[model samples]
Each structure stands twice: as C-alpha cells, then as structure tokens.
Target chain A: MKKLINQPEQIIDEMLDGIVSASPSSVRRLEDTTVLVRKDAPVDGKVALISGGGSGHEPAHAGYIGKGMLDGAVSGEVFTSPTPDQVLEAIKATDSGSGVLLVIKNYSGDVMNFDMAAELAEAEGIETAQVIVRDDIAVDDPENRRGVAGTIYVHKIAGAKAETGASLEEVQATAQKVIDNARTMGVALSPCIMPTSGEPGFELADDEIELGIGIHGEAGIEKRKQMTADEIAAELVERLLPEVDLADQDEVAVMVNGMGATPEMELHVFNRKVQDLLQEKGVKVYDTIVGNFMTSLEMAGCSLTLLKLDDELKELLDAPSHAAAFKK
Target chain B: MQLTVEDTIQWLKQFNDRLSEQKDYLSQLDRAIGDGDHGINMARGFQQVAEGLDGDFDEVSDVLKKTATTVMSKVGGASGPLYGTAFLKMSMECKGKDVDAAVLADMVEAALGGIKQRGKSEEGEKTMIDVWAPVLGTLQEEDFDAERLKQTAEEAMQKTEDMTATKGRASYFKEKSQGHLDPGAVSSYYLFAELADVIGKGA
Candidate 1:
C-alpha cells in the first residue's frame, strides 16, 4: 500500500508519460492511448513486431520497444490484458508495407485480445501474423501454459530477425522456434499488492514460498516452507530441464529474471547455482543474463528461463540492438 | 411479453448500479483465488457503458452493439473480452428483431456460446461459464420464467464456491481455489439477474 504514486487510476498514464519523457529519442507515446511506438515506426520495408500485457511488468512490452526489439507495445492496467481496440491501434500504428507480427503471451486474456486485434487488422487490409509464447513449464498442458520471462528471448531473437529485413513469415517462424525451444519456471517469496485495491493479492508466511507463480500475483502451484537459494535454484532448474529436453553437451542461454523486488545480488547468487547445476549436467552455457529483465510489480521472486540454442539463435542473441532494457 | 429497447437500456443501468454496489465484494472474492481485479474491471466497463448510452437505438441489437464495443474498449481484463464477446454475439442474434421469451433464450445461448468460443473454456472450469451455462439451460425450458431463470443463475453462481478452478489465473492455485466464489461467475449472475428483473417488470 505504501508505494510511490499519485493516484491509483492514473498509474498507466503517468508511467507511460515518464517513459516517453525519459526515452524520447527511442520511443514515443501514441496519442490518447496506452501504446508506445518506436520513434521511426512504420519502417519502409521491415516487418513490425508488437507485444504487450498488464502494466506492472515494467521494462517488458514497452522497454523493449526500440531498434531490434518491439516496434510497439500496448499496455493494459495492472495485471490486466489490453483491450482489443488498443492492440489494434498499435498494430495499425506500427504496420509498414511489409506486414506486422504480434508476439503475444499465453494468458487467456492476452491470447484472446491479441488474436482479436490480428483479426481486426486483417479486416482492414493489413497483413498480420501472431505467435503465442507459452514457455512456462509449470503448466503441463500446452494450451494452458503461461508465458513468463522466456518471452524476452522471443523479443530479442525475433526482433533481430525482423531488423534484418526478414519477411513477416520468417520473423514469426523464428519467434515460434524460440517458443518451442525455451522453457521458464519461477518461485515467489512474497505476493504482490494491486495499486487500486491497496491489498496484497495473497499472503505468504514468513517461512514459506510459492513455486511456479505467474506475474499476476496469483498463488503458485505449490506452497511450502522456504528453502535456501541453492535449493530453490536446483528445484527450478530440474523442473525446467526435463520439459526442455536438454541432452548432454547441448548449449543453452540462461536468463535469471527478478520479479521486481528481488535484488541483483540475490539474482546473481541464484544464477550461479543455475549455471553450476547446468554444468553438472554436462550442458554448455552459451551466455548468461542475470538481471531484472521482466518483473511482477515489486513481488519478491525470480524466474529462470533457458533457451536451447542453435547457431541461428546464438547469432540473433548476439545481434546489436538499442532498447532500454537490452542492448546487443 | 417482449423486451423493448428501453428495457434493454434499463437492464444495463440496473447492472451498472449492481456492479457499483458490489464492486468491493466481488474484488474480495477474487483476491482469494485470482488477480483481484474482476469487480474493478466490470465496474469500469459498465460505467463506460452507461456513459456511452446516449444514442438513439432502433432495436435491442443497437443497444447491445454499443455496450459490446464500449466494454471491450474500456475494460482491460479477461472479463472485458469475455463479456464483450457475449454482448457482441447477443447483438448479432437480436439484430433488427423483437425479443420475446424465445428470442431472449436464443440471445442467452448465443452469449454463452460466445464466451465458450472466446475463452476456450467449459462449464465446470470455475469461470463465468458456471453461471452462464445453467442459465442457458433454464432459458430453454418450456416453463421458462424470469424468476426461475434468476434463481437458477444464483444457484449456479453459489455452486462455484465448491469447485476448483481449471482455467484462468485461479487454476494456478489448484486445490486452494476451492471454498471461494468465482468472481467472474458472481458478476455474471448480477448481469443475468438484472436482465431478468428488467424483463419481468416490463412484462
């Protein structure tokens, strides 16, 4: 309840205003909407990429809106999906002659609204393609999985592909490839508070933690007594490995993402454990990113995302780009 | 008895009032198993719907189409699309036609069908479908009455308290989702109850 803000209802507008002011060179806010588009949008012949979700997950759909990343991001309220019209506006704003690709997360609202936007855009004689990211391994059913931190990989790889003048089909296919090879799992040490309600969505005992929580402050798959950082890392890694089908000597890129409130020091300590565990399994680590790339509005937790890499993915990962959150 | 366009507007006004009164109660229910935004989202959507109801409407479909677009634009949550789809489908069914008991039944069916298709959810998954599906069945009965339909929706909404969620964010909680009323179902019940009240009085 005690956070820095003016009014609960104006959070999205105020935050977006601040973002455009701070990064005027890279991004601009679309008039009368909660959408941020690249300054040089509607690029002559490149396929545009758009992604967005609720507002609390800062530096996600918006922060990635720059060179070699998303061309536009349509933000919703905290923990809420953007309306179809808002997403459609983003598509229209960012669509160039080539086409547009929507990188949608796997939550029900997000999937439905983005799909609706694509349909709306198509009706208006614009070409549109969509790729839904459902990389969270915690949910067993592919149809019901939630997209987590691994979504950033899709942004990077697919954005890199789109920047290279790849066709919309090529960008979508590459994004799907990332979705197919990537897996993520998260553990939450505390629940998040919604600004409008001014109440924590759930309660966690001082000695307890929740495993496999989504970014929305929903309770996780399991609640148990807290474990050491190493133990938690091992548990999350083991849970992700089988789902991703990693074999000996295979290479993978790792992203240890903080859930807003987790400190960088804790994330690095946790990342070290994950690297050690993968090394123990004879897996080669191509690169490791330990930071708060995606967050859950000051919730205390971390998620580990592993993308099994091919030569194509590695090159895209290394491609130079200028986004506020990720560069190169 | 047939429902006039005026009745349709009244139904929406009543639903908006109900949501305004029960917003906090519904949000409290969501706080237990979901993201705790259902009540706020629905209230915001209905408030916009009320504000946008200034145009002349020839039939119930016109009113419903306006409601659908306004809710879909203003409400930024799962309920927005779900309810928007429901109203959109209902409008498609009721377009340029008078709505009697039989047409009302068809509208309910279409709304329920739209939610199922849009959400990819089923009747027992502890969503708004829990309230909507039973109401659809009641609407199809030979002796269908507004009071009976209202009672059936209320019962179905209450029944969601004992069910574990299998869809949406609540599903993440697994067994812990039980013993809490599904917030979407509760809001849906208010919608149907308000509709029935308006229809019964009009009759």
Candidate 2:
C-alpha cells in the first residue's frame, strides 16, 4: 500500500521510462508499447531471445536484456500477463533474419499470451521458436509447477547459444536443456502488496512462512512455522537437489535468489547452508550466484536454484553477459 | 422473436453496467483463489465493448465481432482471450443468419466450443465452461423459459463455490479453491442473466 509511485496505472509506464533512462546506452523502450529491446536490436543475424511476464518480477525479463542475454522483454500489468499486442510488438522489433526465440515462463497467462504472440509473429513470416521454463518444485503436480528464479539461467544459457550464431531451433533446444535440468524452491516470510489492490495477497502469522511460493503473491504449496536460516536452506535445497538430473558425476550451478525484500546478508547465510548441503551430498559446485535475480514486489523470501550442468552447459554458463542486472 | 442488433447492444450495455457497479466485489471473489484481477480485467474489457457498441453496427454478428477483438486486445489475462474467442465464434456462427432459438442455440454452442478450444478446458474444471455448457443445454431444450435460464446461470455460478478449480490461477490452490466462487463463472452469470432479461422482454 505504501509503494513509491504516482498512480497505480502509470507504474508500468514510469518504470519502463526509468529503466530506459538509466541505461540509455544499452536499451530502449519500443515506442507506445510495454516492450523493451536492446539498443542495437535485431543484433543482425543472431537468433533473438525474448522473455517476459508480470511487472513485479523485476530485473528479470527486462534487466536480462542486453549483450549476451535477452534481446527483448515484454511487461504486463502488475502480476498480469502482457497482452498479445505488446508481445507481438517485441517479436517484430527483435526478430532479425536469424529468427527469434521466446523464453517463456510456465504460467497459464504467460503461455497463452506468448503463444498467441508467436503465432502472430509467424503469420508475418518471422520464424519463431519457444521454450517454456517450469522449474519450480513446490507444486505437487509436476505439470502445474510455476517457473521461478531458474528462468534467468535459461535466459543466460540460451542467450549465449544464440550469441554463437546458433539457429533459432538450436537456441530453443539449449533453452529447453536448461529448463529440463534446473529446479527451484522458494519460501516467503511475508506477502507482497500489489499497487492497484493496495492489499497484501495473503497474510502469514509472525511465526510462519510459506514454502514453495510462486513469484506472484500467490500462496505456496504449504505453510509452516518459521524456521532458522539453515533449516530453511536445508528444506529448500533438499527439495531442489533431488529434482536435478545429476547422476554419478555431480556438478551444478547454484543461484540463491532473493524475493525482492530479502537482503544479501540473509541470502548468503542461506547460500552457505545450500553449499554445505550440496557438498555433504558429494555434489561438485561449479559456480554460484547469490543475489536478487528474480523478485516479487517487496516480498520477503529467497529461492534456491540448482542447475545440473554438463560440459555444454558449463561452457554456456561461463559465457560473459553484459545484461544490466546480471551479476557475473 | 428475432434478436435485433439494438437488443444485443442493450443486453451488453446492461451487463457492462453490472460489471462497472460490481467490479470491486468480483475482484474480491478473485482475491481469494486467483490473482484478484478477473473483475478488473472484465470491467476494462467490457468498457471497451460498451464503447464499441456506441456506434452503428450493420448486424448482430458485427457487434459481436467488435466485442470479441476489443476484449481480446484490452483484457490481458486468460479471460480476455477466452471471452474474446467465445464472442468471435458466436459471431461467426450467426453471420447473415437469423437468430431464432435454434440459431441462438448454435451460437451458444459455438461460443462454448471456442472457450474449450482456447482454454483447452471442459466442464467441471471450475471455469466459465461450467456455466456456459449447462446454459447451452437449457437453450437447446424445447421449453426455453427465460426464468429457467437465469436460474440455471445463478445455480451454475453458485455451484462453483464447492468445486475444486483445476484450471487458471485458481488451479494452483488445488483443494483450497473450494468454498469460493469462480470469478469467471460469476461474470459469465452476469452475461447470461442479462441476455435472459432481454429475451424475456422479447427485445
């Protein structure tokens, strides 16, 4: 309710303008639409990478747009999927002769809207491919899991593959590989308030936390009494490591992502436990990222992502990225 | 009675008024199980439909087409495309054709089919299909009573209170989705109930 903004409706427009202004040399907002593309868009003969969803998951979809990451990202209303028209404009602005690859998170609205946009783009003779990321491990039904922080890993690896002049199909296949190998789990200590609604999505007792929370303010798979940082990290990592495809040889990249309001101090504490747990399980840790890669609007929590890596993935993950919010 | 374009506009205008008046209430229902945007999205989409209806339309199908595209473009959620596709299929089913009871039945059936295709859903999924399917059944019956139509929609909407949602954002809640009305069903009730009133007055 106490968000720093003028009007609820203008939040997206103002936010987009702020982003463009902050990084004018790197990005530009497509005119009259909620789409942001890299300044040198169409990057001439490279397969384009695009991803987007609701507005509150900051430094995602958009912040991931730059040199070796997303070519463009669309913004929907707060917690709402972007309309097909907005997505269509992004496809048009970013698709070069090499075609475009849409990296979509697995939410119903995002899937439907992006699917419609891809169809429209195809109708206009732009070859488009799509990869859906559904790496959240909270939901009991594997078919219905939401994509969480693991999506950025998709954007990173897929963008690297595309930068190598890979075909749209190749980029999409690589993105799918990341999707198949990565899994994430998150726990929220509190709920986030949408600007328009001015009300928290849910309320938790002071002593409680939500496990398996989605990026949106929706409730997680289960609620439990709040536990220590180590306990929470163990709970999240235990759920995630088993979901990875690491067989005999176990090397993985870890992302300890904050849910907007969580700070580095707490995230590192959680990260330490994640590493301890992974090491205890005899898993080789290649590289680790600890920061707010994806976030709900000011929600207090953190998500842990484990991406089981092979040589191809390791190489792609090591590729340099100049994406504004990407830490590397 | 042949439903004229004016009557269709009047029917929609009434529904729009209902949506504008109850936008917050509908959103309240959505807040419980879904993302709490159904009412706001529906109100925004129908407002454009209301504006789209202010001008001249050559046929009822044309009016339906305007509503479809406007809602599809303006409404940004699953409801937008679902409602937009439903109206579009209804319009296509009755192009240049008289809307007698049988034709109306066909239009509703087409709308239902479009909802299913676009949402990849079926009845008992706690979606708008739960209301639309039974309403179509009532329309196809020999005795097409308007009161029964309204009651059917009301009861259908009410029945969703106990149904576990298997689709849309509500599906994430699983069994917790029960005890709350599906916001789509509530809005679809307003849609059908308004049509029932127009038909009752032989509009």
- Write model 1 residue lDDT over B1-203, tens digit each, in one string: 68899999999999999999999998888888888898899999999999877789989999999999998998878889999999999999989889988898899899999999999999999999999999989988887588998999999999999998898888867788999999999999999999899988887
lDDT of 1 at A280: 92
Note the Cα lDDT for every prediction shown. Answer: 0.91, 0.89
Looking at candidate 1, what is the lDDT of residue A205? 94
lDDT string for model 1 (A130-221, tens) is: 99999887787877889989999999999999999999999999999999999999999998889998888778999999998888888788
lDDT of 1 at A80: 93
Candidate 2 per-residue C-alpha lDDT over B38-68 given as tens digits, one digit per residue, 9 for 90 to 100: 8888888898889888898899999999988
What TM-score does structure 1 among the candidates reach? 0.98
For model 2, what is the C-alpha lDDT against the true structure? 0.89
Q: Each candidate's chain B TM-score? A: 0.98, 0.98
By lDDT, the best candidate is 1
Docking class of 2: medium
